[model samples]
Target: MLKPYNKKPLSYAKQVHHLQSKGLSIHNVAWAEGILAKYGYYRLSAYWYPYRIRSGNNVLDRFKPGTSFEKIVQLYEFDTELRLQIFGAIEIIETFYERN
Candidate 1:
């Protein structure tokens, strides 16, 4: 069965507020807002998933204790860089094979 999506879209400021309400520590509001604006909340949420509180097989909506927003940003940055590096390597490999 299919269900309708009931969640509403939130602005960047509201997204920050939501995270704070969920127990995420935002050391810099402006920086967090900027990241959210650039990447959108959905993309950044993946980075913060590990920081969320969990019990057994169920993940809660709230974050774990001491889960900082800056750490989430760092994780996203690291993942982006890692993906770029991996793609660069693949491109190089393809180029080498084509010349042979």
Candidate 2:
């Protein structure tokens, strides 16, 4: 089943503003806007999900204290690089099995 996306689209600047409103500490506005433009809000959102404030079983939209946008970007980069390294190892293992 499909549901409607009722939220309106925001510009890169608005996206950064939204993050700030939600308690995300962003020192580099230009870089943050550029990242939003490049990777987009949805793609980068996963990285920030963990920084959101939690209340029991429910997760709040706002971030925890001192949650920085730089940390989110760093996490995203680390995860991406880690996945690439894992895949490279997996490919080697697959090749080894194929050669046997």
Candidate 1 lDDT over 1-100, as tens digits, reads 8899998888889999999999999988888899899988989888899888898999999999999988888889999999999999999999999999
Q: Measure candidate 2: CA RMSD.
A: 1.6
lDDT for each candidate structure:
0.92, 0.94
Q: Could you tell me which 10 consecutive residues in candidate 2 have the lowest summed lDDT?
A: 35-44
| All candidates: TM-score | 0.90, 0.90
Model 2 has an lDDT value of 0.94
Clashing pairs in 1: none
Clash counts per candidate, in order, are 0, 0
Which stretches of candidate 2 lie above 4 Å from their native place? 1-6
lDDT value, residue 7 of candidate 1: 84
